[model samples]
Target: MEPLDKEQQLERLYATPPVYEWELIVNPMHFRTKFACLLSLTFTFIGVGIFILLPSLKGLMIASSPIIVGSLMYPWSRYLLNADKRHYYAINKYGMYSTSEQIIPEIAYTIVRRSAWVGCAICVFAAIFIGPIAFVGAGGAALMSFTMTNFRSVPHKSQCLFDGYAKLRNYRENEYSLYTEYYHYGFDLMIPESKLMSIIGVIKQYNDTFEEEFVDLYKDSKFQARPIILEIVR
Candidate 1:
């Protein structure tokens, strides 16, 4: 029989009922908890600048543009934080499936268009003072940003099959989340803290090479101080 294609694999994965399921809602004030004062002061200054510098409608809009753009950081950060957005995860012996809120394409398109315009403006400003060479750097920056934004805008469903070699990392700080890696691709599953061991046991049955370790597989400098409670590599 021919090997299943990507779509077929997904359909099979989704059709398989999960043995375990859970939901996670990240802290709504996570950002404010970290940057409350800084963000508040920054927006306050922007508000003052808008009123003081821009007396006319056009000037007001232009001057307030920074605030308008900066304001997006809140909703965008909240979206990234998954604030108040409940994420659901389902897992069975065959694989795991997860879902989260999807982003609106219209909003994504607006952001992309504004980003390109900002890049164009920067290019023109730089070219006026620097030289024609500025276009090269600015154009490259625009292209890279556009590409990254477009790629991220595409919807993605996080899922993985357990029929192959895989790695697992359980962070000590977050007892409710499990991070798994298959090949170079990685995804996270949020499970009840009490059931972590039971879930690990289920995974171990399929891949006996699973073991515990303190080492950080990703070697991320920031996470170096964050202890890993358990790690399994196959």
Candidate 2:
């Protein structure tokens, strides 16, 4: 038989009705406060130092632009990206499929507006020090930064399909999440504690090679580490 193409494979996978399905609403502020504070403080210091060194009205605007934009946009972006959004997942005989709701237009607008402001700040800073010629270099840098941001911001896969046969190991990381790896890819499943075992049972039915073992999720030590044993207790 001829090899199936990407579209065909996806069609075949989706044709199988899901045995189980679930949804999760992620907390926008989950484990992010400390990191956000550190980021904001570092930018604040930079802006302050720039103002002190230049000591002018123009310097004030140039320096404060990023700080102002970052302060407002970071939280707004996070909320827009995650608030009220539901991640959907389904499992069948072939594999598991997952997707999340997103506000594409709002997300794109925020990213573009923030990147433009930061780019303008860079251009102004450069022009003050290096004259008209600096605009060329600064403009190039800004474009490069914008391109890199867009590249990173775009989601590579709208829906992720994980093949059951390809799964290598599964680790339970508390009541809310499960971590799994296969070959070069690793994924986290946001499954409720109550439904976790049932989902595993469905997967095991399709994948005969399924095996449970203890392994360190995080390798904190090179010489010695305690491994967490993962198994289904009847």
On TM-score, the leading prediction is 2
Pairs of colliding residues, candidate 1: none
Predictions in order: lDDT: 0.52, 0.53
Q: What lDDT tens digits, residue by residue, belong to model 2 across residues 1-234?
A: 997876886786788888888766544344344545656565556667667866776566555544454454444345443333345677776566777554345656566656666666666665776556543323444454354344223332333344444343444343223223443444445555667678778867776455554455555655422222122222
Please tell me which predicted candidate would have the highest lDDT against the true structure: 2
What's the TM-score of each model vs. the native?
0.54, 0.63
Model 2 TM-score, 2 decimals: 0.63
Candidate 1 per-residue C-alpha lDDT over 42-85 given as tens digits, one digit per residue, 9 for 90 to 100? 65466457557656654343334344334544444444322343
- The C-alpha RMSD of each candidate to the native structure, in angstroms, is 8.5, 7.1
User: What is the C-alpha local distance difference test score of candidate 2?
Assistant: 0.53
lDDT of 2 at 207: 68
